[model samples]
Target: MVVGELGSGRAGSTESPPPDSAAAVLAGLDEQQRTAAAAVTGPVCILAGAGTGKTRTITHRIAYGVHTGVYTPEQVLAVTFTARAAGELRGRLSALGVGGVQARTFHAAAMRQLRYFAPRVLGGPMPELVENKLRVVAGAATRNRLTTDRASLRDLASEIEWAKTTLATPEDYPARAKAAARETPFEPAAVAAVYASYEQAKSRDGSLDFEDLLLVTAYALEEHRDVAREVRGQYRHFVVDEYQDVNPLQQRLLDAWLGGRAELCVVGDPNQTIYSFTGADPDHLLGFADRYPDAEVVKLERDYRSTPEVVGLANRIIGMAPRRRGLPGLRLLGQRAGGPEPRFLEHPDEPTEAAAVAAACRALVDGGLPAAEIAVLFRINAQSQVYESALADAGVPYVLKGGERFFERPEVREAVLLLRGAAAGRDDGALVPTVRDVLASVGWVEHRPPPGGAARDRWQSLSALVDLAVDLVAEQPTLDLAGFVTHLAERANAQHAPTVQGVTLASMHAAKGLEWDAVFVVGLVDGVLPIAQSLNRPDAVEEERRLLYVAVTRAREQLTLSWSLSRQPGGRRSRPRSRFLTGIAPESTAARRTPAARAAVVLDGAAGQLFEALRSWRTEAATAASVPAYVVLGDATLQAIAETRPRTLTELAALPGIGARKLAAYGEDVLATVAADT
Candidate 1:
């Protein structure tokens, strides 16, 4: 068992009264949490286990320090790994009545510093940050006469990012690549040459990419004493969340920010570190105490997020890993009541596994769990394709995490901004003309990309945007360009891509820092979960284990792990269950098997026939229009239409996902199909 000092019940007299003086900020924290929060004076390292209230402890600590006069809110800096996490920290601090605390990701914080000191130190404004580095690198490769395909270019771009994050220069790439045991599609030296050319191009373009923000900021802080002193004077206290994922460049930045001061607190779980591919080192977190000998250490073992059964499975899985020095294993004690035992499911093929998952999700939603409260996490982005089709087939709405948001997409944003610009000078009657001109300006024609790949997806997205504009005009006949632009802006800002009202489909990596009431971990076969590339390397295997651990801990109530025995239907079972399953107690796990061959169940033969007819029509329409079939009509809407057998266009338009534009465009065809069937 791990040990740490507990919070003193007595409130410190020297502490200044916080905004909520009537109630102590430490009132609700557990003993360990309260102690961690109250330790506002010195270096502290918290081994915050999964589901532990790490965020609450740190936010309250900042509030308490402010309340007690130990540190002013302005003097505090809290850095996290993501923009979402930073926003949460800032919001929590505000709720706790502590203002002026700067909570940001390392990139955001460094950029801010760079912006402020660039004029003084670099003799000019900081360069504009490049948004698409791959495009720039591709351009550089072209200039350098290096022949490469799109996929290889993408891989080289990733290599460049890794090298920069690890503080490795062009000359250091070959050795570092060898050390990492990374297999490169191109020669390391060749990639390094492209990287050098990319840098020179950025300099010529007067801009910096994302990685340069941290690198330049670290350099300034080191070479300029006055700048470091100014930053240190402004923020005396530092707190970093998810310290386990901090790369070397970020660590160097943090050290420069602290300037050898001990007024820092870092919280992380070494077992949860899974970003090794991106150059993140958990050793900094594991050896935090050694760096600051006088630091107070705290371990939060009680998990507040997952149920007992879920926590037990997570603990068992992590226990199987080899132990490291200074990194004590956590035996998480679940604070919630027991729920259903985690289900271990096996299917004959990928499609069957996807179907079973979709069926389970539909059942859960039907049983009163909101679709938004559930998620299906897979090992990679590619696994999402079949699951997406399955969910759509089941008429379940879902949002794909890590996919570009509708409003944030380049074509969508361009079109909207054009509309916004045209609206400034155009009247209501001219809206259609303005929209047409905008579309023309954005190069959006009726033509579609030749059937597959990313170009096709982009064309589909653009077509959808045009359809949206058409719908807006049809709905509000009197609305002018300005009114429509205002409406579009409001909706764009209000609804970020992948509306939250649907089942979440995300990669396991993107699912970090999020929790769901029900989680489906799919594609848990040995080669997939451990990922064939990592199988030979022990360290890579360990990271894969951590990835699975992260996936398991994401569930708050229902948890399901699924694997496919074979890649194709009727094929021999080739892939085995992930080796991690061996560590889980058989008694605690429930098993389910899906049949090798199953036929589609048709409840009503007539409705099923009509659904099939509608799908066939939709496929033809989608193919002709060069859009996804779902764009024409969702499976659920088609099913509803078949069941209701809407006789009129009005009735057909009443189905979910059907709007004015769709009604105008497909209403006649849909009515004809239904009438012909009848």
Candidate 2:
């Protein structure tokens, strides 16, 4: 994954794949990458393209400095999306033998410094992490004889957390609580009480949720001169990963930590800025240069990840995004040469689409691609079920991101509650067993039943929870409480967890930092992809386009773009292809014929000769199977395969279009067709 001129196994050694040339050192980089990485003086802004290697560039820039001795790794601060990403970057640095670098998630970094000065700033001990804040809140309500639905409690907690991190105090909660009251469960006063209770609990326990770290640290540094001075002195250079995902809390923390002295290197793909609802603002990244006037800007205009065709499709889609405020322009550099045209697969319904996607994945993997090298991207987390069923049927290995797996399942959570409670010696996990027994025996708790009294509502709600637990316990008597929680955590931590298929089923949002040989973007229709709500706002529409851009670019070599025109299971057909697709011309020959047709043809055939070549090329594989290549393999996959000319199963597997089923079903036939000329 680390790319550079190499000597033997070492990266950045004298033998590194000589930087294509001095002129080509930054060739594979996007305009933003080069600009952000090279700027050593002040703040630099890099609005990256999806899969354009923003993370790679930031890490390497630090490596570049260390290699060039421009700055010690310790002097720089690297911030990323999650704790996992930060660890990955740190490992990458260690792999390159780069030492003294400080790479941590924004929250992690903020907390580290916060804890270092917590005693002085907050006048107390460091905060504890809220590993399961929702569970704690739910348990608290249960114990108080005022049981509430877990969902309601979680929603309330999340809202309170959001407000707090945005620097909203309990006093400020009334207005926000009022505006959100329509959607939230609790009234303003109730919310304020809960917020107070939640903070009290956290402070009493010396624990903090993710957001609290940023909010607390930002306030601490801004208020405490010694802390600010120490931080500014410790790290003079700052490199931020996924800069677009930096919420206001994070931005505040960054500012206070910088103290107007640090040289900033921030990199992110605005197109991948899907966390806006979570308070992240790409505006901070896009406006970096203006924020720091003397900053130099460079553009890494070439991409090394996605094939040109895929890149072209992604670029066109993102071009629809309204320009960011205060930025000159958005430049996407798709450096990879000719490959596949992104296909638009149409399915009859969700189930059918899931089946086809699963089949497609099977074809890719059976052909020789690694399971980890393929992903099925969808709009919503719930949409993954169909794909999961289809994949399970195909006996293909797959991993689900964002869904509660076996361990995180309700049953698993119950098990964990028992185990963790026991481990903490809650009277030999008595509370855990009691909670489980309560849910199992009564189904659910309705301590504060509806106004209809404990009749119809109370019994039903409690019964449901009890039934669930009873069923789980009935199925597995040997499942002790503590053992169950450990199992869930382990299951969640399984990075290479053996999936039913090698494919990854993730929401478009979760697929951000990943890349694969082949990618299938499903459920791309109007109400589904752009989602009906996003159709009105220019910014929302752009965000949708950016989401599409992210999905398309995740494909390293081959990509399949699909949409279902209808949602079945008795529902009337209502959805349409995304209007975003209206801008894209179809590739049918009939659509490509006249003089006036050329513009349409060029637009439809984003890559002219290459597009025609794919459509025209011989395909003995699918021909023998009597199915159109577009069915078994999308046009994008075919184009990439044709252009790349992957000679063997291994190489073909490396292409994104061919999945396990396709490879096993048509590998030889396709290769035979390719071998005819050679």
**Highest TM-score against the true fold, candidate:** 1
Q: How do all models score by TM-score?
A: 0.75, 0.67
lDDT for each residue of candidate 1 in 37-90, tens digit (9 for 90 to 100)? 888887888889899998999998888888877786777789988766776787
- What are the runs in model 1 whose C-alpha is more than 4 Å off? 1-23, 406-499, 585-678
Q: After superposition, how far is residue 629 of candidate 2 from its true place, in Å?
A: 23
Model 2: per-residue lDDT, tens digit, 117-209?
878887877867899988767654454445578678877777676676556677778786454332456666666667777777777777788
CA lDDT, every model vs. true structure: 0.78, 0.63
- Scanning candidate 1 in windows of ten residues, the lowest lDDT window is 5-14
Instruction: Enumerate clash totals for all models, in the order shown.
Output: 4, 47
